[model samples]
Target: MNTDPRPSEHASPCDAAADWFVRLHSGTVSKADLRLFEQWRQADPEHDRQYRNVCRISGAAQHLSAQALRAILKQDAHPATPQQHRRLSRRAFGLGLVGACSSVLVMGVLHRQGLFDEPLETYHLQTRRGEHQELALPDGSILRANTDTLAIARLYEGRRTVELRRGEVFFSVARSTRSPFIIDAGSTEITVTGTRFNVSRTDSAVQVAVESGSVEVSGGRWWNRRTRRLAAGQAVTAYHDAAPEGIRTVDVTNIAAWQRGDIIFDDTPLALALEELNRYLPHPVHLDDTALRSHRISGIVRSGKPEAMLEMLPDFAPVSVHRQADGQIRILPR
Candidate 1:
């Protein structure tokens, strides 16, 4: 009986697989190189398995933002000795580049060697309930996050993209001819060169109100994309799984009053007003009666101090506020 090991079970193919994986992502692989890679991959079963393992390991790391990868690499800045480099390389192949330490070292070395192109920096910003935050972006743009807002900004070399994960944000974009400021709010995407606008994203809808300059709003699915351009004082709403609403004129000053600790409602429904107010209070305000939802409210409500607003609500409408045992405030008909 022959006691020889099969070629597919050998370790040499795994080593070659790792080298090919690095070369493929170097951004300079030619068509002939890819063809040769395919031949090599199909030559041995072990080669394909190793390639798939490398892919699975790198998939999760790809989701990591460029900033996070850089932060990980910054933790170890000293040049690795020849022995350490070889050890790390061996560990990278053995671990399939899945471990955090091995992944960081491999990515860092690949980046320095121009084998991997770095992606854009991604930043996550959020504000708690009843809180507000202001940020100055690297591109000189200003962002004012409202209460309970969650946003992610990805600043690439050619474009600046901000995704409004939840709630509302007011953006004062700086002028940049080379890079456009884009915001992805749920289903809608608002793009502008340099404009001031407010993007509010709810559970089922997104609203974009342009305060100054112009913006292009695009929504709907990938196949049937809908787009509309809005100028100053114009607002647009896009419902989830629905078409974009017609642009309407709005009072920019009243819409943006929340930035100054005030919530202005001009013939707005009571339910909508309550929803906006609840964003700024620890305890949410709920309307007990369905009919009370249609009550039109037109006034300036103070933020952070919900007691005054609750007190004045009874005067404006025939509704009473009840403080529940659970610290929630319910509005019902008197």
Candidate 2:
């Protein structure tokens, strides 16, 4: 949560919920524990959603064989904390309780981060600045690449992997019992079974948001990595070589609204807003007064009409926007 990448720092409400879920169902429940769990659930509305997701996935995986579960623990390559290590051993080996789960709880049916044994065919998906494209993969998944994005897709018999080279991608993945969809974004790895999510990669960071279903965001040191499960309407951001920050609540409907040709900002900083607008603008936008960077901006601009973002600048912030003869836009304090 503080960008430390340590499990202790980055564990989200979802992570805590998973631990509580396992403790309660492990035949080791106590009255005090239940009371504390209830307090946690009530403290934040997101906790309930996170806990329900864990239960639903665990219920679906109740029929998996013990051997299948073992394979998951071994191949996951995630370094669990001492406490989590114990829980994972009990969950994977005991098979009575599964902790920190997604839909791919069955190891025989799961592939960690799309690492496959079969020879795979590869292809690329990309979009130039201001361009948007939607593609349907052979595996029945629909992928949308936003402006200035590059993603590589590799298809094998049972699993699929996509590396986000740059920019943003929104996925509507098809469900598979024996196959999982994986996305490698810089230093982070995301695993999914069936879900809709948006991943945006920038020069310095990657952000993941779930619109429906859920995703596991994994990163941090290889010897001590951390993973957080984000349910629908939740989002996480991480810098390169770091674990994801604390998960944040979001409006899932606005996740990747650019796919609909709309760019929505909710009280964003002026400098940051202009940075995003530059992605679609033919000419870069610059702020003349550094002090103006603190100004807040909130509005909707049509992606197809990038210039309109500049037009609306004056209506919100205490700044004036002007277009140069060369087409570049500059903002100055009023």
- Backbone collision count in every prediction? 0, 0
Best candidate (score: TM-score): 1
Show where candidate 2 strays beyond 4 Å: 1-119, 220-225, 267-272, 286-296, 314-334
lDDT of 2 by residue, 34-53 (tens): 78778877877887887875
- Local distance difference test, each candidate: 0.72, 0.72
Off by over 4 Å in 1: 1-118, 221-225, 288-295, 317-319
Deviation from native of the Cα of residue 304 in model 2, angstroms: 1.6
- The all-Cα superposition gives candidate 2 an RMSD in Å to the true structure of 14.0
**Backbone clash pairs in model 2 (N, Cα, C under 3 Å; residues 3+ apart or in different chains), count:** 0
